[model samples]
Target: MNAPRTLRAALVYFNDFENCQRFMIDLRWPDGVVRCPTCGSDKVTYLADDKRWKCYAKHPRAKFSLKVGTVLEDSPIGLEKWLPAM
Candidate 1:
């Protein structure tokens, strides 16, 4: 659960999809609140099935994934593979 302390642990820790998601969430929103990257609205709902979030703030870009505003944004690569590499 704690951040990976070494390369081997990071490889294993980031291999799981859920772990990668949780890590990104914590890294981006340390306050434990997921916000809309576009509108910066706290009024967002997680779409678990799609692995994304939807903001209720009447905006064009209402849906986003954890990588939306990060350097990983728009990449086709999965977080499980990306996090460890980073």
Candidate 2:
């Protein structure tokens, strides 16, 4: 998102749940192509209900979230706080 006109506006934007989720989603899939981090497969399906992406490849660890493979992995804190604090 473009820089807000004020710091308060930035805070308001980051506090929004949907906006934060969108930001994380975009950050995870910067190229607009969602791939499985485990198996390196592009045929992944977004399971919004589960808040994670599932790979089409047959594997036990076929699901991953934005936190996976990053420093934020397994973080219980939501992105609304974690991302902004980063």
Tens-place lDDT digits, model 2, residues 16-62? 86677677667777776867889889999889899888999999889
Model 2 Cα shift for residue 7 (angstroms): 5.4
Q: Give the clashing pairs for model 1.
A: none
Per-candidate TM-scores read 0.91, 0.75
lDDT of 2 at 32: 61
Model 2 TM: 0.75
The CA-based lDDT of model 1 is what?
0.90
Return the TM-score for candidate 1, rounded to 2 decimals: 0.91
In the range 40-77, model 1's lDDT, one tens digit per residue, is 99999999999999999997879999999888997899
